[model samples]
Target: MNLLLARGANVSDQDGSGTPALHRATHARHKAMVSFLPENAANVEEKDEDSCTALTIAVKGKFEAGIKLLLSKGCPVNFSYKPRVSNTVSCT
Candidate 1:
């Protein structure tokens, strides 16, 4: 991942769902990647299509490490996301 980033990978690039690497790393419980992203200029404020931030994904999934990492980095806690789709939100 570092190699890709070093090669100019767009850290802020989003998928079809507007999910960036930060969101994916947080949701996957990848604390290191999560930390690396924002440090490398990935937007801490980027939200997915559901209006959920990395912090929101961490909290919803009960990913303790991801939560602590994000919070310590000054991510917002007052977000209130409302998903546009009816897909089930995975909490694990």
Candidate 2:
């Protein structure tokens, strides 16, 4: 995966379920994989079938390291839910 990323793999590409590499990494708790992705992987902000971003999933899945990485990479911490609740407030 690191080699592929180095060769310019599309880190932002979504899977059939609209899950981005970041999302999968977070779900799998693959901290190294999460770190190996482009530093901007969190910034892609791809939404899954449930309209959840990697940051969102990371928080929900208790992937604290991934969440921290995402935030450090500038992923929007203030992302809001469709129902209008604030993600930052609720996720914490």
lDDT tens readout by residue for model 2, 1-92: 76786798887777886778877888898987777664645444566767677778777767889888777666666665343354332332
lDDT at 78, model 2? 61
Best by lDDT: 1
Candidates in order, TM-scores: namely 0.82, 0.69
The clash count for each model shown is 0, 0
Q: Cα miss at 61, model 1 (Å)?
A: 0.4
Model 1 agreement with the true structure over 1-92: per-residue lDDT tens digits: 88997798998988776789899999889888988888888888777886778998887788999888888877888776454366435221
Return the clash pairs for model 1, or none: none
Candidate lDDT values, in order: 0.81, 0.70
Which ten residues in a row are the worst by lDDT in model 1? 83-92
| Residue 64, model 1, lDDT | 92
lDDT of 2: 0.70
